[model samples]
Target chain A: MNDVYIVSAGMTKFRKHNYDEDFRLMVKRAFDYALNDADITHKDMDGSVSAYFSDHIQGQLIAGAMTNDYIGLATKPSKRIEGGGATGGLAFQAGYEEIASGNMETCAVYGFESMSHLNTWKGNDVIALGSDSNFDYPLGGFYTAYYALMATRHMHEFGTTPEQMAMVSVKNHGNAMHNPFAQSPMKITVDDVLKSPMVATPLTMLDISLMSDGAACVILASEERAKSLCKNPVKIRAIGSSSDTMRLSDRPFGKVPLLPNESKDDYKNLKYPGVHSFRAGRIAAKMAYERANINDPLKEIDFAELYDSYTSAEIQAYEDLGFCKYGEGGKFIEKGYSEINNKLPVNPEGGLIASGHAIGATGIMQAVYAFWQLQHSVKKHLKNGKLQVENAKRGVIHSHAGTGAYETVSILER
Target chain B: MKNDVKGTEIYKTDPLIKRWDYSLSYTHSYAQDSEFFKALGRNVLLGSYCKQCNYKYGTYRKYCMYCGSETADIELPLKGKIHTFTTCYYSGEPFMNDVPYTLILVEFEGIDSLFMSRLINKNNTKISIGMGVMAKFKSLQKFDVNDVYFIPEL
Candidate 1:
């Protein structure tokens, strides 16, 4: 097996696009920008992968083929990948595998979502289709309601308060103030988030991510190729992917999947991975940590780009990633453990909450920001150094989909 | 030919975006779980029990998710407690007008899994976890999951 390195990455400003900006235009912009960032052109790429969550939102089927042709990679080896919100992260992993397997020397992964075309409510219906359509959707299983259920359960199981969840929105939205590519950056307070219009009980409109229209692209190359073609390339240290039952009800309780930093006794008598926690996230993070030889995440991993589709999910991730013990995530945040200036700055690029979640583009957007961070080029890509973690050497990018069905974690190092 | 093609609906004037409405219903089949929906019309909530693993599901399953064995249909208790729940102030197109509705995951007696259903008559009722609720079937059956809902136990 060969080593994979991210030579360059690019992301569009995540927001509601105007009438003229379709997905093709978004992909072209990110693709071209990525190539230019690496000081290379499309001619240097060997293959590609395209990602988008729904053909319904794009208003076109087989949209990946159109994007491949539009980006002038018409004859190159390319395919589309979709796993709901994990589409972009899956694409990034696919591109990494393409080079790691020696099937291609260089690969470009591009993802886009044009969700602005639909009304917000309608767009949510399309996303909710990712759930068990037969069982949940008919029972008014709106996505926010599903997260709300989990939030309520988290609160019951762990004494997690709505205020703790609100603090995550406050932190991520606050960080976005310095990130130009982020959509909704604000100096929000916990009170502001708590007072926002309730979409579901315990989750206000402010606690959720926006349905955005944007694109992101990352170019992965073999170590040999990256050393020659780029000034600074970040190593793809390890990638881990895992899944759980599609229906949340189908997930059975079991022993918590332990990371190197934890012990079985830590969660004794604890009903683990209930709706309050994500077992898939724990397994994925554990796999990545083992492969990357990371013993203690809180001490080793410099930062994290967590999938914060909802504020409560970020607190859930802190435990799943072993940054803190389960049921202590709320306290972890209250102590400012995840703040940008504190231990293990999370979502320095503002995460899905404040950065914008364009579904397929979201996971790759995390990668784009992580690549810039590891290269010590946040000032170069973001044009503002306010959100950059100091002396960052390693980071984790996580992407999640469904209620808890799919999770992908990839470690990146300088 | 040009005159014939000029009948497209204009969605927006500036960018020449055309209005293309994609509203259609799909005939979705429940396939193996057809019994569950049919049983709801009889006011029976059907779940699956794995004889091999001795695990029972609160929701219908053709196969045991844990042991991968064929599951036999089991009649689930209609009365259950709210394991967890959320009240929606917003929803999808189908349930959009039904905003402020409460959805719950109910835990049945002797069942290992939970079932999702709407909790009705929650207008003035304070819903909380461990609250006892009973299933109420629709008088007019839709043959969908919507046919059954829960109300606060009398």
Candidate 2:
């Protein structure tokens, strides 16, 4: 089968519009951008789907209906897909699966969210709502608390300091300054992150990703059509997905990638012994490199868009995804390993940490940036006043929702 | 004397009037999300089983789905292992403010299934996943519909 290609990708600036502006309006903007980027019209061939976390958004079920009606994809074999935080990636996976399986020639994945529909606290309450309501939500252990428990474990064992955790915020916000779509863009210091108010011990307000309203869309097609119709066609090298128990408390900490039951218990904060969010990337990247036939991924891949819902998560993912050795994530960032000009540029698009977390949209948004980079050399774009990953021939996009409970890893190549 | 600083409130009358009044209680227990814990009230811990693959889903699903099989409901024993947990300092519900409580996802022993429940013992102890637990139900007077917890088997 021919390769699946990302012909066009674009996103609305991730910012909170009034609640009066609902999902439909948000997606109309997203469809306009994606279709423009793809250089096609809604009348173009094939089907479509909208990926998102609907239970947390407006409780109105069949959110896809809102999107389908807005983009008029209703008659075109549409449905909604979800996997908690990985919902966007899962949606991309389904759309890609359609093309790979020869069901459709082209598909569009629209992800939109209106967090202002529910304030952060209310939105969090809603996210926890779909979880085991009888057991966890009643105890008030939602997303923040789940990560807090992991932070406590990381500290107890690895000597990973809150300052180091705070560094994630400092580093991410620093990257956000260069990002146009980021909600909170400012130059913050480690001291600022540490001095910032503590939302949870070991996790300050700066440590978590923001809940902002936004939407993003990506148009995927076969390579032949992409090369002919689009300015650039970013190939879908590989996509990886994995799920663990509901909460970190239910998983056993693993010592190796996908090799569970290893001896050490350093990351005991996890309930499952052998799984990690980064492991998803490991599998995805391995399959990606294998499919693309590249060895030495660290050297071959020039840039990365890591899912940075929390700064600590990005650091941990650095180790888990084989970008750096374990425990060196803190050091890697300290020395600027993830800096735009460093060995590997991570979150050049301001990551979930820099830009606000838009749930289902982030996974594809990250991949879209990789699409831009693989097609347009970062060196060329950076000079053109765009955030660029220099000389980027291949790149990886990582996103995880709800701590490490669900993760999606995607790789892109030109 | 300490004075509580409070904000002013606006009150207005609406043109519509209602004649009926009703009382309904919304319970918050962070412990149960499905029939599993309520199953504990009947001495059975319920888990979701995939009819397609027979793989038990640790979390609940509206559709009993796996690779292909529809999921079915399965009954499990009350005893499970306390897997991992987080103690919440804030509560969305006011009742929880009385005590900062721990919410845990317990992987039931002899089964690789997980159930979200409260970690309760006669005496307070550090909560962890490996801690053994069995279903314990409080009297209906204190039931709150969420009063069942994983109490020390002793």
Candidate 3:
């Protein structure tokens, strides 16, 4: 019933913090920056929502409560939201509800994750617990292997080459050079990605998103509150979330959920979402596009901050979000369609692959970058403004978790 | 009572951090899906079919995922083809020493879904999609999904 807008956005530089800053302090840093950016203090906030992925990583439970307290909102009505990697995105969605439902005029959404405490393998096992522990965990595969499985199938069915996947890493990592907050910025070629140490067949280390320690926060307000609090507010035009089977084995083949720009005939001969594609992503995009009144997302949306947890997943997302037809994602990247100056610039902030993925903060990080892009504050926020889309008006930010299990898509307008 | 608590080991000096080590062993019940694990010990793979809708789940399920009806356990064919596969050069703690292992999602004839398992590849054969793989079970069972794996059918 009410329009929601992002009044301010802020985040910590995404990289391994080496225990220099705990999750609580990291969140405070982001929250303080957000409050200052919005020109508002905690006294002006209504309610709060917090997100983080693993208690094991934090070495504490009820981290949301801890963060809320640390950020000076101890007595406020606050709730915690977690959907694995989508925790931050889902928290933003919840904060939107607070304003849209008239429950709160201005709400604060912050998310953080501290993953450096655990060793890489042990940390991976902790994340692997998000899978059906009873079924998939015993196989001893890390999340990368699961994604690698999908990558192989995508290549098999669509002739998606490892080179094309490598191109994604080159593009994203190269874009990160200008992003001051990015973790692993690089000026590399496809060969660099291909020659990187192999983590799984067809996927090298460079193809993966970094597991970092970071925090991000965004301030949300209703239309009236936004107009009064901030000079230029980025409207949360539309939001949508969808989910599928948690276990990858349980995803049943079904009709491809068509976006407004597509038809049934497009995928008539293809087996829909056969581990090669994500059904939840397609459905989430469809729901958001329909609500946002976007028919051709690739043409209409100025840019996107996709959840590129893996370079291959980014390609899959391009197709699922209808930027290109299914099976054409690899070709789409090959043509530089998602470059900073291309038809539809994606992940101009370097994405999770090039920027960093702090699990819980990942979704919120996307929102933060998108907010800055929409506000035309790229030069103000980052070292270079070359990543900014020319005359950018609207954009999409996506969050994903598990093996195509939980997904969220939100549309933001300037 | 005598004070017997020990101090936490200081992990880092610069950051002034303490090391906290903890482990949890959960005694979990498989509930309705216990038969699936139990069947693995007998060198059999047990999937389930919905009693109402007759939708088959290649992965064991006590209740139909689609119809929410009670499911009946059914033995699956031991031989299936690889729908997809990945060779992990790195993995979690349990499989750390067993790096460069292969994992496969096996698709069976007439089955609407796929089953996940490790591929032993005893003969060091090249694995590919649609390659035939046959189920093999461990004599000493752990009652875990790893109790059964697939080997190249040839």
Docking level of model 2: incorrect
Model 3 CAPRI rating: medium
Model 1: CAPRI class? medium
Q: Rate the local accuracy (lDDT) of all candidates.
A: 0.90, 0.66, 0.90
Q: Encode model 2's per-residue lDDT on B1-154: one tens digit a residue.
A: 1248554333323422222223346675434345654554565555666656556655444354336444566665667765545555443433235345565556664444455666665334555546777776665523332556777666
Task: Give model 2 RMSD, 1 decimal.
Answer: 7.2
* Least well predicted 10-residue stretch by lDDT in candidate 2 chain B: B12-21
Residue B122 CA displacement from its true place in model 1, Å:
3.2
The residue ranges of model 1 lying beyond 4 angstroms of the native Cα positions read B1-11
Per model, how many backbone clashes are there? Answer: 0, 25, 0
Model 2 spans with C-alpha error above 4 angstroms: A253-255, A258-295, A377-386, B1-154
Off by over 4 Å in 3: B1-11, B122-125
Residues A1-414 of candidate 3 have per-residue lDDT tens digits of: 799999998999999654788888999999998989879988889989999999888889998998888889989999999899888888999999999999999999999898887888888889998898889988985899899989999999899999999999999999999999999899999998999999977799999998898999999999998998999999999998899888888777777888877889988878878799999899999999999999999889999999888999999999999999999999999999999979999998799988898999999999999999999999888967888888899999999889878899999999
- Residue B24 of candidate 3: its Cα lDDT? 86
Question: Residue A94 error for model 1, in Å?
Answer: 0.8
Candidate 3 at B124: error in angstroms? 5.4
The ten-residue window of minimal lDDT in model 1 chain A covers: A16-25
